[model samples]
Target: MMGHAHALSGIVGWMAVVPLLDGHEFFGLRFDLGPGEIVAGSLVCAGAALIPDLDAKSSTITQTYGVVTRGLSAAFNWIFGGHRNGTHSLLFALLMGGLTQALALWSELAVQIFVFLLLGIAFNGLGLGNDKNRLASEVINAMGTAAVTLALYASGVNYAWIGVAVAFGCLLHFAGDMATELGVPLLWPASKYRFGRNIGFTTDGKVERNIVTPGLTIAILLLSFYLFPWPELLPQA
Candidate 1:
């Protein structure tokens, strides 16, 4: 799947799970999330949905950070046996979620530092112009966006849910890939099993554009309405 498709899937997945997490139980555990937590989770999931594709240099996520992601992507490719290996695996998802949870202990500081680093990457990657003045302007813009994000965090947003959202987003990425012809290695290291072989259309194929993407988009819109129904739709008393 493409970057936008994966992002849509992640958002839909997060929204679908929100209601379940609010008062439902799963595997002997329960979640009681509030509105702010749900928003944070959705944002994190949407952002992390692009993480698996970091291995591909031409991928949207990679280009977003430009050269800053090269080393990390290379490291991942080396460790996971290239593009669709470990990074797309269930093990990777669990590890990422656990790491996020651990880091959430210093949520405020962690978020601030992360925002700063991300802005720095954006400043370098925006490809506005090589001129010093243009570069400086882009940097300022990136910093301004980061500052706004930091302010939002300081305004009482819960960061713990971010980790959970990222984990779920990665998992949804795997699921989206599974719908492609190439499939994904759901289990890695222990076995080289590639699941979802030929189950759906090829990458960027006609069916994907005409059927899958549109279907997912419609589902997302419907789910959004289900989650937050309009007041105008209420019956008149």
Candidate 2:
């Protein structure tokens, strides 16, 4: 699947699961998902959804931070055995979640900085800026990312569940790819089988561009209204 589609899947997947998680404990972490947490998790998930593709040099996530991400992509490609191999596996999700959770546990500032970076990636994936102008796009993406991060910080958003969200996002990405013709190898190394291969629509084809993408966009809108307390958020008349 394409970058935007993966990003959209991340958001929709997170929001779809938010109600089940809002007041529950899962995997030793208690979730108290408020508005800020919802938004933060969605963006973080969106960013993470692009992570499996980091092994692909031309992936949106790889191009997100230029030299930094490019270098990371090269390393991941070498370590994971190229695009759609180990990085697309379940093991990759666990490692990413573990690393992100460790970062959160280690330093609040580091987590915040990481969130800022992920938000920037999410914005780029969602095509928030005019890509025709590369410099302008980067500047705009940076500004937008900063604003959202600051707002979430001011709202006292707690990111205790960030690791879970990241892991879930990567899983969602795998699901998206599984829906495409070139399916993901969810159990790489253990088995070289590519699950769901040639069993779905073509990537970025009619199904994705027309049906999937639009459907995801509409879902986000509907979920926004359903998940958020509009009356509480609105200014008093």
Instruction: Give candidate 1's error at residue 136 in angstroms.
Output: 12
Query: Distance from true position, residue 94, model 1, in Å?
Result: 0.9
Q: Which ranges in model 1 have alpha carbons more than 4 Å from their true place?
A: 24-30, 112-155, 229-237
The residue-level lDDT of candidate 1 at 156 comes to 68
**TM-score of every candidate relative to the true structure:** 0.78, 0.98
**Please, what are the lDDT tens digits per residue for candidate 1 over residues 1-237?**
877677767767888888878777565545656554554555567667777877776775665654677777877778878898888888888888778767766666886565445333323332223256855755665666576466556666656455677788889888888888766888877778998978877877898789877887798788767776457547877
Error of 2 at 232 (Å): 0.4
Per-candidate total of colliding backbone pairs: 0, 0
Name the top TM-score candidate.
2
Q: List the residue pairs that clash in candidate 1.
A: none
Candidate 2, residues 1-237, lDDT tens digits: the string is 899999999999999999999999977899999999999999999999999999998999999999999999999999999889999999999999999999999999999999999989988999999479989988999999999999999999999999999999999999999989776778887988898888888888999999999999999999999999999999999
The lDDT, on a scale of 0 to 1, for candidate 2 is 0.94
